[model samples]
Each structure stands twice: as C-alpha cells, then as structure tokens.
Target: MTPSAPPPFSTLIRTASQQQHTEAESSTFMGDLLGGRLGVEAYARYTEQLWFVYRALEEGARALVDDPVAGPFIRPELMRTGALARDLAHLRGEGWRDTAVPLPATSAYADRVTQCARSWPAGYVAHHYTRYLGDLSGGQIIRDRAERTWGFTRRGDGVRFYVFEEIPNPAAFKRSYRELLDGVRVDEVERRRVVEECGRAFALNTAVFRELGEEFPLSA
Candidate 1:
C-alpha cells in the first residue's frame, strides 16, 4: 500500500564532504584565505558568518513554522535546544554583521540550486529539496558547528531547523519522492539538465571552499 523510504542521503553528503581536494584546500583556506594562520581574525570572521547562516535558517523556519504543509515536518522545540536565534540576537547586539565583505560562497550555490529547482518537475524538486535540506547530513554539519564552534545558541530554535522524522527506514519517503516525480511529467532533457545543473551548483559550493585559500579570489 505504501512505498519505502529511500536510502539515506549520507551517500552523497559523505562523498562531497570527504574530498581530498576539498579537505586539503580547506586547510590552506583556513590558513591563507580564512586567516587560520592569523588566528583570531579568521576565527572572528568565521563566527560572524556562522551566525548569519544560522539566523537565515531560523528565519526560514519561522516563516514556515505555521505553514499547513511544512509545519508537520518541523519541530519547533528543537530551535531552543540550539538557541541559535537567541544567540544571533546576542551577537547582533554585540555588533555582528549579517552581510560582511566578500560574502560567503553559499550565496552563489544557493542561486544556482534555485535555478535547478525551477527547471525540475515541481514534485521531484519538492522531494529533492525537502529531503536534502531537512535531513541528517547538512543538518549534522549545522549542529556540529553550532555547538562546538559558533556558540550562537541559547535555546532549541536552531536545532529545530535540523530535526527530521527518522523512521527505521526511508522507503516511505522515497515513495513520496517517486510519486511526486512520476506525477510531474517533466521532459527527459530538461529534467536531466536540471539534475546536472544541481551538480554544478554543488561544485560552486566546493569552489567557494577551495577559494578560501586564495590570496584574493575575487577582484570585485
């Protein structure tokens, strides 16, 4: 009667996270670009950006918290557990900048990913985004960074953005995804291109990290 959940998205996340290129470059990035060598300045800048990202997630969660469709998938109590929102408030009062010079590469990745969303069949796109954004991998990064490094939390609101309904398996979720994709009736070429473009979007993100090691990546 019901379809099964898909395999965990960890396959993709892990593959991306563990790139030797990304890792090696990140070491340089932290030192050269991020000021890992400089120590406090880089750390301060990193914290500033981290706060902005968490704040963005909080805003997104707040916007959809009461949505008829998205509400059930999200649990608000998690927000306070991480308390990112409260932390952001504290940081802002402390003079944090939401948009500092040389903005994060995530902005570029987000734009391209948005285009992929547009070209995708609405059903499949919904599945892709909801599942990708709502689960273990990306959320795990957010949680780890927030607690260990950022210190931008006083409650569970930040955590709310990371929580997902973890069933024993993901078959049910996959079924939902397949049904949505199947129903969308997208053209083969356009759908394929969208998938490819999504990969490009990911690469853009990778590039951003890679560029962090650059002495000066952008001219403007």
Candidate 2:
C-alpha cells in the first residue's frame, strides 16, 4: 500500500483551530457591530483597541525580520499600524492617542503577541497568520458595514485599516500566504505548537470582544 500524503500545514492549522475561530467570529460584540445594531462609537472604541494590539504585533516584529520562520511572513504591505493610526485619528481626532486605552483583555492580548514575537518566531507566525489573514478575510465585512452604516468613504481614513492598498489581489496574496505556511521549516512537534497558538490567538481576540460587548451593551 502507498503511504498517504500528509495534510498541508496550512490546512492542518486551520482545521485544528476551526472551533476557536468560529467562537471568535460568533462573539456577541462582533455580531452587533457587524449587524449594524451597534453605534459608530462602538466601532471607534473597537478601532482604538486594535491600535494597541497591532502596535504590539508590529513593534516587536522589527527584531524578528531576519528569522527564517517569521521573516518571510513579515511583508511590509501587510502592516496595519499606519492604517490603524489613520483610522483612529479620523474617528477620534488628533488627540485620539491621548485618550485611547486598551482594556485589560486587549493588553493581555498584545502582551501575548509581544511574547511570541520576542521568544518564539514560529509562534509569532501563528499570531501573524491569525490576525493578518483574518483582516484580509472577515475584516473586509467590517469595512463594508462601516462604510454603509456610518458613511465612511470607500477605502478612506475611517475604514482604511481593512484596506490592503499594496495587495491588489487579496485572493492571490492569501494563496501565497498559505503556501508559505505549508513550507514553514519546523518539525511535527513545533507544527502542533503553532496550531495550538492559533487557537490561543483567537481566544485572546474573543476576550477583547467580550470586554467590548460589556462596555457597549445593546440598547433595550
């Protein structure tokens, strides 16, 4: 009998984390915010939280740019810090940074990304994959809703964080991204650790959403 082909690493990681991914997507805060039931203030607050998380993700990334596992995945075009800053400025004005604060969950989430990026590059890739890919995918839905619900211009400052100006074809970019994942240089044990980290990334995300939901409860 012929040996069966092993599953692609990208497929393995995604399939392993499907439940956590679903739970994060199904969070009540995301539901209301995406459903248009929540106000623009809620969206702005969410954006503020994102700024903190992305800053942590990107800031620590500079040190890892040379790592074989994490370097290939650190495409400049995928950086969200600048775009997130623009969105926050547009939403809350010039002094937005002064008042913006990460909830406990958001801080914890950013800390994890920092920890991974600093000590474990492969694990950093897991957080990187979880975030940027999700932004490229489900995050677009957010841009559309924000534009329609709050009148932000298409790809304008308010929703620019979701826009990948450098990546003209998101589908193609995603394919290449998955290819990189499939080719990542790691042993089976490390691969399983990366998959577990992906689940953890989504859980951290859900915690942020839970806090947001608490802060911005739906109107009766």
Query: Highest lDDT: which candidate?
Result: 2
Q: State the lDDT at 79 in candidate 2.
A: 96
- Model 1 Cα lDDT, one tens digit per residue, 1-220: 6897533333333343345324433454443433323333443443344344334434455545454433443344333224333443444443444545334564554444344333333322432343344343444554555444434343243333344434334456545544434443445554454445435544554555554435333322
Model 1, residue 164: distance off in Å is 6.1
User: Ten consecutive residues with minimal summed lDDT in candidate 2?
Assistant: 211-220
Clashing pairs in 2: none
Question: In angstroms, how far off is 3's CA in candidate 2?
Answer: 3.4
Off by over 4 Å in 2: none
For each candidate, give its TM-score against the true structure: 0.45, 0.98
Q: For model 1, state the Cα shift of residue 87 in Å.
A: 5.4
Kindly list the per-residue Cα lDDT of model 2 for residues 1-220, writing each as its tens digit: 9999989999998899888888988889988988899888999999999999999999978999899999999999999999999999999999999999999999999999999999999999999999999999989988999999999999898999999999999999999999999999999999999999998999999999999999988942
| Each candidate structure's count of clashing pairs | 21, 0
CA lDDT of every candidate: 0.41, 0.93
Error of 1 at 44 (Å): 7.5
Q: What is the lDDT of candidate 2?
A: 0.93
